[model samples]
Target: MEIFKSDKIFDFMGKRLPFLALSALLFLGSLGIIFTKGLNFGIDFAGGTLVQVKYEQNAPIDDIRQILQAHPKFANASITEFGTPQEIVIRISGSSTELGNDIGDTVHTLLDPTGAFEVRRVDMVGPKVGDELREKGIMAMSLSLLVILAYVSFRFEWRFAVASILALIHDVTIAIGALALFQVDVNLDILAAILTIMGYSLNDTIIVFDRIREGINTSKESKLLLVINESVSRTLSRTTLTSLTTFFVVVTLFVFGGEIIHGFAFTMVVGIIVGTYSSIFVASSFLAQLKFSVNNYRAREAEKLKKQKEKEKMRAMYEKGTV
Candidate 1:
């Protein structure tokens, strides 16, 4: 369905300079935020031990944090109420076997010498394993980009492949910057969200690229800028509808998904917004900047003309021979 009924022509590519500048500013700002503030890696990457405690009364989250702060081992522990105010979840720093498998006893003894509170459960991850997971996550992101690069290059043109990649990276960098800026826990779920965002952004970009390719193939417009602008304008409705619907769902998830998938939902929310923006502004504008050549189209037309001439020549020969 089309949102816009008018055959209005938008000079989207004409005002690309300001948009490109804005994109650059945002991209560099995101990089700076990432390097300076850094990601708040969770147990999946940073490695840590978690303990769930059930206090006899209110969890006393502030008191527990104050106590843990004074202790050398848990000086930087994470303390929060899980379910009811009486149910507390404490995360101990360090991924050693002792912290992982035995921190429960230490926490129980230190928090409640009288043994009033109960140590509900304890979970752990080794430092080595955490390092491996981090490496693999990086690999997964890199591999996905490489695959997209190769696929787009083979499917369309190198310019489009590069443009789409730029848009994808732009979307990811901004999304990750949001995570670091807000100090969101970068866990396995967040990584999954990043990958999902990459795919989502790529799909949107491909739609624009596909329209541009169609415009070029059909010689719908003489100027590359017109082709790009028309193509983007044509697909604008589809992009808006898809983005709005997906955004509504992710916003709902962010509100109600709970802490278990909170970061994931937040990532998706950022992805949808930034992904749509890059698809229209970044990907297509970059093509406009490159002055995408029509030499390939000229060559194809030449080939078609050559075949037509050959067919005509053969027909003339047959008519002369009266065969």
Candidate 2:
């Protein structure tokens, strides 16, 4: 089905300055939020205990919170309903293995003195391990971007690669910034989501870059800006269709995937939207601003034509002499 049938001719490059300015403000604002407010690190990144408890019936969340607050050891714990009203997950900050063992007993005694509640699971991550994971997560994200830069530069031209990387950075920064702004809990799953976003954003950018390269090589458009605009217009339908389908799937996951995958789904939703925008506006606009080194391509083509003419002249002279 065609969502957009007519070919669009949007002057994306013509309005690059304004779009870029908006992106800059967003980027800076996100950075500010991250630095000031910081992310709400989950148990995976911050040392903590996660205890999952299932009650025989629907338990009052406020009663559970009040009970935990009554105890000195569990006073600062974060308690939330996991999957259903009958199940709740309790998170406490610490690396102590003893706490993991004792927490279940303590919560069970406080909530259900007769043992009506069952401790389904108790997980703990040490502070040292959390620190390591945090470092590795950062490294993984950095390495992925570096590898993408190398791959794109080799596959296309350096300018396309640079623009694509910048666009990816923009997508990631905005995604993380949104998470921080909204106080979403950051964990390994969210880190994985950010990496996934990078890959998705890169794929979208590469598609646009591929189309632009094809236009530059074949189209007789005198201006690079016009070539870019035409390329984007040609791929507009495809981009829209792909983004829409992906968005529907992610939104579905966000709504129904439960707390376990909530962060992942949220990241995907943000990434998809930002990625689509960057592919069309940010990446393509950079190409237009740079003029995509059209002069070099034109000069190369002219040299090739000159060489062909010289060869033809020599061939003609040789034929005449033979005659």
lDDT scores in order: 0.86, 0.86
Per model, how many backbone clashes are there? 0, 0
lDDT of 1: 0.86
lDDT of 1 by residue, 200-290 (tens): 9999999989888887777557788888888888888999999999999999999887666788999999989999999988888887777
Looking at candidate 1, the ten consecutive residues that score lowest on lDDT are 92-101
lDDT of 2 by residue, 262-299 (tens): 88999999999999999988998876666577768767
Candidate 2, residue 257: Cα displacement in angstroms equals: 1.5
For model 2, the superposed segments whose C-alpha errors exceed 4 Å read 100-102, 298-323
The regions of model 1 sitting more than 4 angstroms off are 53-58, 69-73, 81-88, 100-102, 105-121, 301-323
